[model samples]
Target: MTHPDDDDELIQELALAGQGIALVKMEGRVFLRFEGVVDEAGLHVPYALVPAQGVLAKPSKWRKLEREARAALIAERANERARRELDEHVRAFVRELAEECEDAGLAPMDFLHTLADLQTSEPAGAIFDRIRQRLGHAVERQREEQHAERTRQSINLAEYPASFDVARRLPRRFIALLGPTNSGKTHKAMEALAKAASGVYLAPLRLLALENYERLLEVERHGKPLAVSLVTGEERRLAEGATHVASTVEMLDTRTAVDVAVIDEIQMLADRDRGAAWTAAVCGAPARTVYLVGAPEARRAIEALAERLECPLEVHVLKRKGPLAMEPGPVRKVKNLRPGDALIAFSRRDVLMWRDMVAEMGHSVATVYGNLSPEVRRAQAQRFRDGSADIVVGTDAIAMGLNMPIQRIVMTASIKFNGVEEEEIPAALARQIAGRAGRYGIHEEGLVAGYDADTHEVMRSLLKEKPVPLNTSGFAVAPTLEHLHRIAAVTGETALAKLLKRFIHNIDVPDGFFYPRITEDQNERAEWLDTLPLTVAEKFTLSLVPVTTRVASLQSAWEHWAMSLAKKKVTRLRTDDYVLHHMTLQEVEDICRLYSAYAWLGYRLPEYFPDVTLAQDMSREASSRVDSMLQDQNASARRRRPRR
Candidate 1:
């Protein structure tokens, strides 16, 4: 009997038809399967009819096999004769052959088998060789046509959307706004793009993206969809109603075709962690008009890049284009800060202490730092801008966003931690952070002063010209916060190292080196717990689980602790033993008696009872929580959803 499974049916049918009248051998009988039945198309009909299991083969079986074999041979001969005559016209004949085989409704293997028989004088191998050669040539021609079309598309340099007149007076596809620090390059770029029908603006940092989106709303004219948006991290889409979008470079992809593309802080192309975003925008933006807003230092780079794309670069040089009533001179450092000045520091503790000191000095103050939420930063920045905050203490976060008018800038220190190690500020960073003092079109001129013993060096670095933009490969791929949080939950360093391998940074590192380093950096909570006066047995028990085995184990433990301590006031203590505090009372007293405010926070931590203040020490945190609860109650009373 013929096989019932469709896949094997074609193979079985072809085998039976080829042998014709073939005997089927069983335990006690011989049998034959019939095939090849014909329809009106003069095609032979094929089937397989096996004899009964117990029946012996009759004498007529041999005769039937002989007759079918002769017919198959004759059919094969006719096919070969036709193919030989059609050699010069093989392309057209093969097309016809393929179509005929398809129309005959034959299975793939069967069609190949019959086609193989077309080689009467030669062999099956030779026939296949001829077909493959013809097919390859056809495929090559098709490929060439496709390539030619792509070339045409790439060469046709018409501006995207065909909505702009870039070819006329501009005589170029793109216009770049170049200027020095705080020279209003971005402001002008935004003005130009806002005039356009639709466009996208890219900021180097997500904080700046939020700043730009808010600024766009203030400047927006008409009923135009101020549908400005921001995309960063996983939290995407704000300014959803605006047609325009201000976003970080990482959020940029070739998904939408905008009329204009504005890239701010073009000098960020030198950033190693995110340089690729700038490069991609330069090379891959599909916008018709691209405005690069940055300092004049990027002119050469911009020109070279434009030349590579065979496009002309229009440079708009803006040199301090704003009100000119104020004078810029060498800054004078003061031991005591003046009211209505901005004091900048690089560390969180320094900022908080500075704010406390300045307030104690009878100045209303606000603070800005990387740790503060964006909304709080904005509000604090606005207070400074409006003269509400006499002094704003912050880190480098204020260097990029929030325009504030200031007469003076007081830099607390010149050194900063650049992710890995402490280093002196680079010239570019010094200029950028210093540039925040004077707002073009707002302040006539800005005074930037440094306060530390090395004030002269800091001032010189700030006044010095920015260096040539450095070349960076791209943004460094860092582990996600989720990964860090997961490691924070795991007990031991070994387990954390295992998970670190999955990160792009530690993928190639060995466990011995990678585990300890990543665990120390990422699993801070676990380390904190071990240090929090736990017994040796408890510590060992906690360390039982290797972080590398499964990140979820750590995550679970961390979540449990986080939930438990979410409302608690935990102190961060540094001293190893309380007895040492008692035994070395004189030594500790001398240490504490020393009035170096900086040293008290920095070096005397080991002698201090609790090195760092806990949440309970700060009455402000508790007051803030009370305020939050009251606000929630008020919102409920007003029948409104509480703003997160």
Candidate 2:
């Protein structure tokens, strides 16, 4: 066969001959165009041609060139086919390897780079064999780690004593008051506590505690005044020779024995963030007779707990004293509103707007919400109760244990954005808010109204349905100093927050119980505390600070107070010069929270935070000012409205 280089040389020779070339063929069939130069005449010119037969011979250069081209085409096609097959095989192997790694809980990404390199190199089969061997070891290691985790969880659960074990030491009798809202469950429980010679009242909210404390102080025992003390996170008021105490659930003084103990809002045992306190109080309160007051939904769980404790249990199912019915249509505007009407709003801005709107309609208005201090909420409730305010605009904070003689409840919206998402009010919550409408002796019937058609329908449906029963409760294993030390030693972690997280992860809860996870805010605060120069125990204590971290100013104040406390310095608070008139409601609320945090720390470390009395007075003043401001704003709005 003629080489390609020879064909190139022949083409060059033909180009230099000056004859016009028509076509060139590998088989030597060439066509040539020829012309002769003449004076106004054309002449015949000789044309050179290459015969096809001569070139077609076996030793011809044209035949060799054709043969070489055919061989190269075949080789290229075969190479392409081989490369496709190799890619297909590698892809199949990778898929199988990925599945195996995932099934064993091993990360396939760790070996992805190595697998990619092997795919492009020769002798890939050997590398794949080595990868398979390593994968087997990885699977074994993963299994071992899972087993260790399970074992650790079991050990953690076994370290703590169950409620039954703790209750076995005491001769306690339990009485549960199960009913829906407006059922007078809390009232009955309070009556029992009042009759007892020495007792305690545990309320879910500080407002409720304060209410009961004042009630007890006014009660006459054997023609003499009863001595009652108030204990909450923010303030404490001790009466001389006091044998009865009213306290928030977190301040239940579980170490002291009492004749009777009343725990209100027992249904809150299902709350994710604060349920642990309720559980602890129920399981550990040192009382001869305990009264559990809440909705009927908590009956099953409380029964189970009572059975476990081997206590004498009696259940009283209370019925509502007055009728509760939903209004037929929506209440559109302030013109349709009336005296003794409470408008419920989800946000502070909404509450303020509604209050102003109602006041412009010539009705006096008071406000209540979660951000307001306990004292503020109480003062607002008092105004509504005393008929000093013609109407009240509030939030779900009223639904918990506040006693207001509201004849009707008008919900502004059926849905509220609960921090994470917008959700319709649950049946239980709806019932609680609606139940606030009618007072037993005051209003013969309670009416629930909605602002819109959708809200009206939701309210009607919720009032008709029963609350879902509580099937599970959350519990956490209490971490002792020993437990913390052990977890740090095992996990090689020096940070208290990290150690607490690890310990919680390894705790084994019962079948119907779960461990509450730390909230995002809590985790953020804990991370910030981890940077301080404090011991692990101190950091852990600071992480558990009861101050609300959602407010930026309050969080900053708390961190500074905590740092001072950690340094063992007597922190002096400047509250005398706090100008409540110049501050917004939110700022006043933040200051109230700061005061509460200081008081809470004082209860734990009195030497470090000795300004509890001052903090309490400042908090009370801040709360009173907020209430007064709302009232003043309402009067101003009423005056500004155009006269008819």
Candidate 3:
């Protein structure tokens, strides 16, 4: 139960274990932090044994694999988006031109002469001035789209060199896709997993997981059901004996058995809390083969490890697959809000503010915040895709994965809070975000702009230059013991025994190796059930609880909720997070006057419903008198109901 001691023995053990950590000096002080720790246990510890200045934010090499994979997907989606935008812009122009001809009310010859005479080149001539003004608007629109095309082309060019080594023949197992950004890594991974008899694709982030799950369903070959499932920390979609499971590695764990395992973003092996999942997936996958896909920077190290472990590792480098047209037109500056444009912001509050601001301008707006439920977020994204929502304002949550056709991207701000500190997005992150514009299949081109009037000049310069290549070697950090234990717990003793028999699984984990320690906590189960208050229909919808586990009290509540829905009535019940947060806010506001803003606006901003007054008071009263209130309300409600 004791935490690992912070000492040299542990550091040396981590170093000798080939866990990516090294000794260094910072400001003359010796320091130690994860340099390439890619094992399961090393990744869980947050603070490293190092001087503060030497702390690196980079993830492990395995994570680089994921970045490369995801980067490829971004390229594909970006190209598609660009092509669509190009077609739309051209159509809009033609439509306007046709309307203009109809409104002239003159013969073609007369119209031509009138149009010519409408302006003259002579000095101080009003006729010529008027003619030039009319032509200017048309010229501006043309320039805007042309610039978009150029940006799109630039993105295409960068990806071309990355997808080259791609081959048609599918590998049986041990297919490792290695490439740089925009190389189409994930696309290939998704293809392999979809074609495999049974497989699971693991993503680093929940957003990516959801995106992969949807894509799997979309590309599913029609026949009998694909039996695909999705798993996140809070959500689970299990089908009876389902074969395909696209899940976040943190959610799936290594104890899982499958015919094939597609581990996306293997470079996340450098992550502190989550890298262990990636490490476990790579080192302990039960599948016949594990496709280790990622960027070139991480290839040598990964290949070296595969050799040491005696596992067959085949490396496939996808040369950049597509070509981008040269000298795409100049980027258009978009300081003003447009109906069809996407404004990229960095925070939830900013997304809300922008949504309200743009909505007031008579444009349909949809907000995509990370805190929203997955179902709600997906629905919001769909609204944008179908053009129901003119503007989709969001945090970095919309940065990658999902494809939306957008003509231009407006950067509202450059600063982003990376959990602990506020940092300006480097050119690499900027290029990635800006690349969202002008999807290839969606538009012929795209536009990338920064909001600061000062930065318009800088943006112009950046647009002219190629995006910098991302580093891959920086990702080889060790995994954490916490992850190893979680994997052990999920796999259970029986499955672990089977995996241990496999040579690949046996190669790793130290000698006299004991399984990861796991505490059986029933509180977690109770907490999970309390989190989502489901109706009877929803219970049926998810089919999660076994018949043996169902309780009368819980069943009655679910039945009542279901009946309320049938009657088209709202339930008084609140989401569990809302209830818990509301109480937390009340405690904050109750402390003082100035601190009230922090409570009301900071912590509980989402829970403060405008239509509900005295919400805090009601919450406090309920907490203080839960038994009494429940008894009275339950008795009265039962009396009012007819006898069953």
Candidate 4:
């Protein structure tokens, strides 16, 4: 004899009462057990069911069930907080990888034949790393194999200059300026550019392009005033009588031959994604004289480029005007940070955290990271340059395009996130960043140090280690529309993705001089775009839009644009009018990138996306808003905590 509502059916029915009911079992009989069984009105108090062991005392599994229930409750109570955190972090780790694995049609985790504890003695990070190995290896390996198969079929050509239209532009003079930091190499190149009546300066970043554009505008060539214009994906400031242009490397004008051209960061020929641009610039820049400026390690590659172009190359190597040295010891703590120091951290989160900490320590902070718009970065850098801000906190964005007078560089870590795992940084990149300190005329010498003892040692060793020289052969090349279209006409294959794959797999390239490669992002985008109802040229153009696949907002916007293009609808540029007070800095940066992509697409497909001018205006306004927000936020932080 047990409680009336002790059956499974009644138990489930009680579950619908909007509260929990405890159920108990004994031998083959069931019992209802609930704690303080009462409604808000106390209506069940008199008729509440109660259990008494004496009422149905029989041989039962109470001894076992009670033991398990008590043990489970007690066990959960011990180290419960630690266990809960561990469980949560593990779940998050697996969840992140699981999403990536979803495309591979595999689960990110696996089951075992035996029972295992929910907790582990190993470090959480190590365990996560171990799990990472299991989930993505197959998919990643498969991708590698696919790429390898395509590359295996790559043809070798001793002489093929189809990448650029430089056949008639040969016999050009090439001046290669190679040096360490503070060597005035850029100044030398710029001076030459200013002396030329018609010239182009190709910069690695738009910020540099804009900077050099302004520098050139204030100059007169042979007492004749020179009209300068700025051209970048974000903006194009063309003057009425422009005789010279400063543009990003990607925007290099191959058709228009200038009197002189300066290609900054020529070592970027080894860059996987944009190397083709440098190759094209080198091969197609129809200039009488060209300047190649980069590290001395790029000498071999530069020589190869000159040989291929059949240009007379004159090399100049300059020593640093000021000295650079490793710090004797670590900075150890934030309290030891000094003025004129550029604090380096790899991730945007770390940069922001360091900025706040430095702010609280009474130094007004200027921030720079990869996500900040070039305009915003320039403003933040200006504060540091003008001595309004004590120090700057940044990532590798500081490694290039900055003109700050940093006397020292204090690295907070020796590792950086490469969109994946944190790994030791390469010597060349570390030196490039460390070289930012000790600008000529700013300080006698530049110092580099790490925050802690271990990282300090790593950075010191890295600085001493020689930078790896690039290969003398096999510069990266990408296909032009002409190359792709010729293949289309030959094979009658109008699918852009197939054409791209065929180009990479079947194109003839020199064995070790120039090879073809399409970035994985572009290939992926091409595959996705091929599914849409669009022409081959349209798909190819959309594939090259400057959008990162990892960003959901960017990917969604890109897809929407492609859809609009396929529907033959006019997609006008749209934004929040730069009033992004509610959005975060990263969000604002992403909006800027979106506008940039739109501007790029508009320039390519003006008939469909005709708001390039509007997009440029909005991007500038957005950048200004971001800069204002950074400055005001720093001031607010100072107000909250005055300098000690």
Leading candidate by lDDT: 4
Which residues of candidate 4, in runs, are more than 4 Å off? 1-159, 222-224, 574-579, 642-644
Q: What lDDT tens digits, residue by residue, belong to model 1 across residues 516-539? A: 122333444445444444433233
- How would you encode candidate 4's per-residue C-alpha lDDT over 504-568 as one tens digit per residue? 87666646577878988888888899889998889988988987878899999999999999999
* Structure candidate 2, residue pairs in collision: 1-64, 2-64
RMSD of 4: 18.6
**Which segments of candidate 2 are over 4 A away from where they belong?**
1-166, 473-492, 510-517, 565-570
User: Which regions of candidate 1 fall more than 4 Å away from where they truly are?
Assistant: 1-172, 219-225, 238-242, 322-335, 472-644
How well is each residue in 326-394 modelled by candidate 2, as lDDT tens digits? Answer: 888999877899998999999988998998888888888888898888878888888888888999999
Q: Is candidate 1 or candidate 3 better by TM-score?
A: 1
> What would the TM-score be for candidate 3 when compared with the true structure?
0.46
The local distance difference test score of model 4 is 0.76
- Give candidate 2's TM-score: 0.75
- Per-model lDDT: 0.51, 0.73, 0.47, 0.76
Write down the TM-score for model 4: 0.74
Expressed as tens digits, the lDDT of each residue in 100-171 for candidate 3 is: 544543222222233222221222123324434555565555544443443333223112212212111222
Indicate the residue-level lDDT of 168 in model 3. Answer: 10
The C-alpha stretches of model 3 lying farther than 4 A from their native spots are 1-184, 218-222, 293-301, 304-308, 314-340, 454-644
